[model samples]
Target: MHQAALLGGMIHDASHYGWKVAQPPHDWRKMAEAVQNHVKSLNWGHRVQLQDRKVKYFNFKASFVNPHMVCGVSKGGEETLLSADHIVIATGGRPRYPTHIEGALEYGITSDDIFWLKESPGKTLVVGASYVALECAGFLTGLGLDTTVMIRSVPLRAFDQQMASLVTEHMAVHGTRILRGCTPLRVERLSDGRLQVTWVDLASDKKDTGTFDTVLWAVGKP
Candidate 1:
């Protein structure tokens, strides 16, 4: 994920200064493949062990049956029960969308989808001020995309204010647009495949609108 950002920054700087460089246009498909391959390479040993039947991997949704037992349901609706000495809860989480925002779930994508996108998110509006939001916005901006970060209150509220300010300032110094004190109201899709977003400035109670190719909800994971 960070490598994408680094490559984007380098490309952005080169293009900004009009450097004569030979490089392919930012292709999300190619990037996604590269990322997946890199990850697979890093876990080759584990994959080999699983393939050799030395380890068992279950790709299913699991629930506890009792203190010493567990049940898992596979995608095909097959159930398997097993007893273990100890069970570990390692299931990961996903991004959360604002349920109150109209058309949010239907029209917007989350951070989870960004990394796997097959096409470039041309112009993006990332809602939230968390590290995930900032990091994504940073990379999108560096990739020469018109990237904006919308903050309802402050940036990186969970971290030190001074450091957070620095991070936002740095992003601003780059090409990332920052919208502070603003909260999204709704998202609507245009006929031409673009998204029209409506938001409000909390301080002034003023409403605004913007069109973007992507609306990413980076409001933190549940």
Candidate 2:
């Protein structure tokens, strides 16, 4: 998805080198389908690799029955208890949603679903200050879309402040609107199916509203 946006800029830069090229319109659907297919291929490859190693893979929800035993339930209510010499549990965190906001969960999408979108997300409003948030906004802007980022406080808050400043500055110079010290209060669907976002300025305690085609949440995971 990131590469998809970079291609546009590369094409434009090529023109400066005396290359006769016209920037073609981006086809969001085509790019999304390609990305999705690539991910599916990777998944299939993983399963094949495990099979080659003579490993049994189960598509089930697993719970620890004991230190060496586990209970797994499949989609159709088939339950099985398997015991092994050792056990390992790997848990990856998931993105957090702002459920306190009236309509955030219902109207906003997380980074996980952004790349799988079927259509272009026009005039997008991205929420959060993590690298994921900045990177997503950056690519969306590079694709010639209207992009805005709403940061509750400083951007890249967990990273080095100086380097984070440089990144945010670069994004601002390249057409990404950065709303500092602000937070979204709610999201609503307008009559035209566009999203209406209401936010508040932390410093002034003032409320403002804007309309967008999509709202993306990139807040950290729990």
Q: List the residue pairs that clash in candidate 2.
A: none
lDDT of 2: 0.93
Candidate that scores best on TM-score: 2
Candidate 1 clashing pairs? none
Writing each residue's lDDT as its tens digit, candidate 1 over 38-150 gives 77787887778797986688777888899999998999999999889988876779999998999899999998888777788899999999999999998887777899999
Each candidate structure's count of clashing pairs:
0, 0
Show where candidate 2 strays beyond 4 Å.
66-68
Please give, for residues 48-84, the per-residue lDDT of candidate 2 as tens digits: 9999999999998899988899999999999999999
* Candidate that would win on lDDT: 2
Model 2 Cα displacement at 180 (Å)? 0.7
Model 1 vs truth, CA RMSD: 2.8
Which segments of candidate 1 are over 4 A away from where they belong?
11-24, 42-45, 49-55
